[model samples]
Target: METDRKYLFTTRIPVRWGDMDFYGHVNNTVYFRFFEQARVEWIEGEGFRVGPDVPTGAVIINADCTFLLPVNYPATVLVKMYAGQPGRSSVMTWYELYVEGDERLYATGSSKVVWMDTRTGKSVPLPDTLRARFD
Candidate 1:
């Protein structure tokens, strides 16, 4: 968990059986999918457009996750998003994952989301609306 993080958004994703690896746990890579799903849902819920056609939007520069416990099937993952202080063009976003209705954290992760001009594929200043949320 990150201290001094601004609560941003959250979403729940059901874990599909196919998400499991041979070891019978959710694939390590699936954690990132959960993170991305939460991030996109929040961003869109905030009324920011995302996609190649958008003139300006978000891009992930990097992401990482720490698996604290195994996630099994027939579970819904609750992803709660938090944000670090905003910079000129980017913010550090954190996520805490738990099985819905469970107190134990399954994982924690973070990603750097940069505001960008999609056409140019270059970073842009954070949108005022986005920066306001971090404030």
Candidate 2:
């Protein structure tokens, strides 16, 4: 997979006091939300629909993040995400978080989601509409 694909996304996020846990850093759970928001924003920017296309859908099967550094409050953060290698029914995505002012890397992660037929609850192939949007 091309690691450079992440350069395709641009998402700015404000650091909220509530997002920090007892560790004085953004909680681990919050990273998932940030990644999701970034992906949605990127899709919207590309003019792609996130909902079921012709009554089909996708679900995340696996996701993981590796924290390289802590992100504290009072600083803005930026998250960048991009599609990775496409599979028969799934696509991997890469995500990176960095401090806005200094570009300090805080974390990196990836997620794999599988397209599925909502009615039957079985994996399905990526539709042309969806694939083209990512491509």
User: What is the TM-score (0 to 1) of candidate 2?
Assistant: 0.83
Predicted structure 1: lDDT: 0.93
Per residue, candidate 1 scores C-alpha lDDT tens digits across 10-86 of: 89899999999999999999999999999999999889977778899999999999999999998999999999999
- Candidate 2 regions with alpha-carbon error over 4 angstroms: 1-7, 51-54
Candidate 2 lowest-lDDT run of ten: 1-10
Q: Per-residue lDDT tens digits of candidate 2, residues 1-135?
A: 365453558699998999999989999988888888887777667664677653566578888899889889988889988786577888888888898987678998888878788878899897776677666
TM-score top scorer = 1
lDDT value, candidate 2, whole model: 0.80
Separately for all candidates shown, the number of backbone clashes (residues 3 or more apart, or on different chains) is 0, 0
lDDT for 133 in candidate 1 is: 84
The per-residue C-alpha lDDT of model 2 at residue 112 equals 86
